[model samples]
Target: MEHALFDDLVQSLKEARAIAHGQMPASRRIKVTAPDAKAVREQIGLSQSEFAQLMRVSVKTLQNWEQGRRHPTGPAAALLRIVQSAPDVVRKTLHA
Candidate 1:
């Protein structure tokens, strides 16, 4: 509704279009790859239910991540990385 805000929005849309068409490079880019949930679980020697419980997520959510229907983000992604690299630490910390 404000004039400045509207102008800024239009400028952003133009920038996005230019980026989409490769007319200009994006200002920033970030790439985050989701972990393989099933492999992490297998490496930890845990069942789906057990892994889900440890992750503090529902079994269906775990299944979604495992099946590639969805991705874990933010804290979940960080935890998955930890589980992959140092599963024993996770197990000890969580079981304690």
Candidate 2:
């Protein structure tokens, strides 16, 4: 029937679109979710200057992250979270 044929065509188009967009049927692209940078810094028991020193980034960068003026991306974002949960791990990784 024409209705059945149209349904098949629509399904095929959807499959093609999903493939073009690199979706795996139901998976979405990974978004890096970061915590409150200021809170993370505080938890590590460091002032802005001290934390920036430990992170090896400028204090302005830390301020931007905390204020959400910019978000950390890629390895920096990953390391920020690691620094939040396991500071020793960050220290070891950085020094290593």
Report residue 37 deviation for candidate 2 (angstroms). 0.4
**Candidate 2, residues 1-96: lDDT per residue as tens digits?**
699999999998898798788784644567677778899998878899988887888999989998989988877787788898899788778778
- Candidate 1: misplaced stretches above 4 Å? 1-32
Model 1 lDDT per residue over 1-96, tens place: 999999999999999999999999999986556589899999889999999999999999999998889999888988998999999999899989
Worst 10 residues of 2 by lDDT: 24-33
Query: Where does candidate 1 clash, by residue pair?
Result: none
| Whole-model alpha-carbon lDDT for candidate 2 | 0.84
Query: Against the hidden reference, what TM-scores do the models get?
Result: 0.66, 0.62
Best by lDDT: 1
Best by TM-score: 1
After best superposition, candidate 2 residue 76: deviation in angstroms? 1.3
